[model samples]
Target: MNDLGKLEDLPADYRAELTSHNLVPLWPSLRGVLPPGKPRPNTRATFWAYNTIKPLLLKAGELTPIEKAERRVLVLANPGHGLEKMQASAAMYLGMQLLLPGEWAPSHRHTPNAVRMIVEGEGAYTTVDGEKCPMSRGDLILTPTGLWHEHGHDGDQPVVWLDVLDLPLVYYMEASYHINGERQTVQPGRGDRQYARGGMLPTPVFERSAKTYPMLRYPWAEARAALLTMGEDMPQQEAVQLTYVNPETGEDAENILGFYALMLRPGQSLRLPARSPACVFHVIEGGADITVEDQAFSLTEADTCCAPGYTAVTLKNRHADKPTFVFMADESPLHRKLGVYENRG
Candidate 1:
């Protein structure tokens, strides 16, 4: 019997020999290294109400300038992810960025892939690699890894967007890099294609050297129309859904990150099968009761919730009318690459 109580009785030289050989005593650390069964993270169904934080965001905008702050963002930390600089969950980072009219977040690019889901306001745009893509509510703007991008708001109201990034993966790989650029604006007529509707890419330009999808902006009008059409054609249980994909190859936008939007009709509920990668869902419209494992989160518009990896989730909308829309981002691609990703009904 390897009794921990007898650890002190062991000879000092013997312990020294174990340490000198760089051996970790199994008795003292076995439980942690190998749990009895499946691993369970400390995370629970967590929610962040936008109404509760809106004033704080406004205050932040009033106190800080885009030039000084570089980017005025409030990171949404997952308490279960630990006390450190937690964002969204353990493997992803989420932040709400505010861009005021007449101000610009200077051009910069980093190794980690990023996406912005517009929460409120309009007439703001992000320039990616010389292409200016306008931003509006419900638009998804991709800031692919290593691409030069800057954000500016020209509208009357402040532009607010939720920033999601695979920053944890970047830190884990220690491959993070940021390069500042001289120009904040892209040349006019660089990205002049009209926003396509009904699952079409306005431009089919594929760069041989590109690391991400060439299309930068996915407008709300197109998404909403397609989703409604999908609702009518697909099973009523999962009414509507769409995944942002690469126009060049018709695959995921990026290998390390994925973005998807879904809609559930009134009084509808669907249980999502478990998968290896965790995800954070931003409530875009209506309200839903999102249950993860045994815990539940009642989420409303502008609110966000999370579902840890491999945890069973069910989304329910009990409203008499109005469908619920959710935008979610996940790190499933990494797990899939490692051959550890799994999903089933």
Candidate 2:
């Protein structure tokens, strides 16, 4: 019997699935979410690593009653006390957010660079700053470091999306900052040109007036279409060689300790052989399994998981229905200083 509620009750075989995937936490695994010796069993690991060694389940059975009832965004930060110590570094924090159908997460924004990957949704749209990003499944909509953003159901049924933020990275560093958006809700396309990452004429870099990241959004659909039209395919043992560029300087997203996206397709998996930098992964669409140093776990839309630091991971999708994709992120502190990062998986 599989019981997601009790982490320890998980079937030994299923839980054993993670055996080979080495998950090395960036910080020594914390004793508990609250202060140590709080009698909470100290299972949680620095807001990022799963409390127990088992992979986290996102289904109704897995969530606490409050999380299921309130439709909140569950976060598992990277295993760091955290940095984003300043608003500038906030853009690098990543969070995994899930909203059941008809769930409306009241509007809010902070000084962190943010993005949403449509994991499971027939129809949804995120109005960022003021521009609306049509939420097709697997689409990536960026909410620049700061700017008001909210989710609404203007289409049919429920939707699931992954939210990534570098908050812990900032919080641990004592650089956390928050600011309420000026407007209650802003339209995206109907003449709201200033707030969008795409479909806008404003500069992408952070401005003196804004509290967070410089750019406002990066639409995944547009990026996906471009990749598909490129007439390219993944190389053996490798998905594809693609990197998010800093539009202003032709640099990679890591240059600024920034966040970015990576795509995967059916029967595609890159063998991540070793841990270099820590990253959080959000499944935008389809299905795939991750292998971290001998441990492996499969995931689908609305499902989020983290890859611990110093351990490499391989992402593979065996789905036959449509192309499976992922929106992945990392903290910029160490990567930016190194100027480069790579994965053999």
Candidate 3:
């Protein structure tokens, strides 16, 4: 018998008629379709240890060259969700891509907006539309939709970065498009960081899939300094956060994905109540205890955690020596755009 305990007892002819009309019994689905209380999500909070996956990433790079593999990535799959698909949650997709020295991931552009957060090592750069944005550890880079981009490493050591994209939204709309570039460009132009220049600028026309940031690369040193200044006025117990914004509008609320930086000093714990929209957080430095949806998880430098939508999260910096920094990539922009984003806190 079916879970409802009655659907299977229906007459075969009746079932056939229901199928012919493209209709099915709702009794078996009512529990999910119509719940008793507030809405709950299927996605779960999960964590990935950097130490456990680092060796595997290096091994993959050793076995398969970047040219042959295209993109060598280890996706942080949510245990609550099926592993067959590369996704962090139902709304977001996050992966750790490694680029070995002297290797390159051929240029390609797709519809899903992407944010690259550098985790370990450097001397690697992502070239977007003939402009090369050099990447350093803790740097955040934006690869807007439909922009040709490629990652290459010329440094002595391998480089790894978190690739967060809005895959669920793109797939749902059935608007995915990808095209490979002829070859990696040897020369790349520099982008202007207009916001840093402190000049008034006129509002520019907005396009659906266009460049949002005047500068694609957000360096770590500058971000750190800003966080430090923000901490001066912020309460000691609270976490200091800053969003990577589009200089033209001074907003991080892009069309699909959102990016931000968070810092928590030792003994600081910030609790985020249950909210709708999945978020991928990468540990930039230090260690902490993170509670996601009432489950406890330990995260150290280079580790990653996914707080799925409708899940409560709390971050505690118990380490005695240093501060904990995390880079967050989320689908809040898309949710906000649809006017469905919500939070209980």
Residues 1-345 of candidate 1: C-alpha lDDT, one tens digit per residue? 434434456688988998899975666665565556445655555778898778899899888877789999888888887647666665688889898888888899999889899999988999988888898888888888888999887889988899999897788888988999867556554222433543454453763434345577888777777787778777544537788887657778777878898988878888888777788889887888999988888888889987887788899985758888889898887778888777854
Q: After superposition, how far is residue 9 of candidate 2 from its true place, in Å?
A: 42
- Provide the TM-score for each candidate, comma-separated: 0.88, 0.59, 0.90
The positional error of residue 38 in candidate 3, measured at the CA in angstroms, is 2.8
lDDT of 3: 0.80
lDDT by residue for model 3 (66-160), tens: 77889999888877777866778877888889998898789999998887888889789998777788888898888888878998888999899
Top candidate, metric TM-score? 3
Q: Which of 1 and 3 is the better model by TM-score?
A: 3
lDDT of candidate 2 at residue 180, scale 0 to 100:
46
CA-only RMSD, every prediction: 3.2, 13.3, 3.5
- Give the C-alpha miss distance for residue 267 in model 1, angstroms: 1.3
Cα lDDT, model 2, residue 122: 67
